[model samples]
Target: MEFNITESIQILTKTPSVISNLLKDLPETWIKTNEGVDTWSPYDVVGHLIHGEKTDWIPRALIILGENEDKAFVPFDRFAQLKNSSSRTLKQLLAEFEELRTENIQKLQALSIDEQTLERKGIHPEFGEVTLKQLLATWVVHDLGHINQITRVMAKNYKIEVGPWTKYLAILRDKK
Candidate 1:
């Protein structure tokens, strides 16, 4: 599929609502449950997404546009949400994610990026040079990845109970 900026933005903008619709009002036990010792819970996933909204996506885009490969983007702290989300409730995190995402999308739109700008290059600390288009595409996929992760983790709570039906459910069968 073509990477239409408008469609990408639509997917990016809808993430918070999708997350809230799936997670809001759930029991704390359910929201905080993990598939295993090291995996993230639904709450943790939301916090991690909040961290990305605050630190990763737009900041990296700005670096790409402003530096134009002159400066390498900083390595992201993938676990920032662990410390940063300690004090906030799931509701607070959701609200913050929505607000930050909206603000970032507005900033992105304000950049007035065109085809040439989308082709602009930035240095990634780990991946070396990458295009603005690649970065934006990653941002969209990143959100979807987390949404799928949250769903899988939640579903696994029923893995044992589902028993015979696990054969039909890829989420239950695919345990990492």
Candidate 2:
């Protein structure tokens, strides 16, 4: 698949703003509901994404740019990072997350065309020898996936379920 950097960057640019706005309207307490649930609260979710961009995402991007195909992918401890992300306010965490995302896009923009196209080689613990473009694509997909997760969590927390027909409509939408 052709990687449209412009489109990807646009998506990357909007996500944090969108997420930030979502949080801004929410009550601060809502960001940390159901603490012991298997799923993360909204705060934890954003924190995880922040940790991901700083540690996993940026490092992988650098490794790809550096053309270190033989290197192993680094593992990140997201939960631990989230726990230690400070006892700051939810708004502060949201802002920190957006700042990190902005940094990621800046780094992405600085990549030369050649660097972006370079054949990345990394040994994933499960899937080996992945390409740079593939990793970039995965990063975009990861953003959307988490947003979807957040939507689901929001719906669940509100005890609002789409009807059977709505679920069918979603499946049909995916077909397109």
Give the top-scoring candidate (TM-score): 1
For model 2, the run of ten residues with the poorest summed lDDT: 167-176
Off by over 4 Å in 1: 67-69
lDDT of 1 at 52: 84
**Candidate 2 on 68-100: residue-level lDDT in tens?**
445777776758645766486778777888888
Model 2 TM-score, 2 decimals: 0.80
lDDT of each: 0.89, 0.71
Clashes of each: 0, 1
Displacement of residue 4 (Cα, Å) in model 1 is 1.0
TM-score of each: 0.96, 0.80
- Candidate 2: which stretches are off by over 4 Å? 34-36, 67-70, 114-118, 160-176
Local error of candidate 1 at residue 128 (angstroms): 0.4
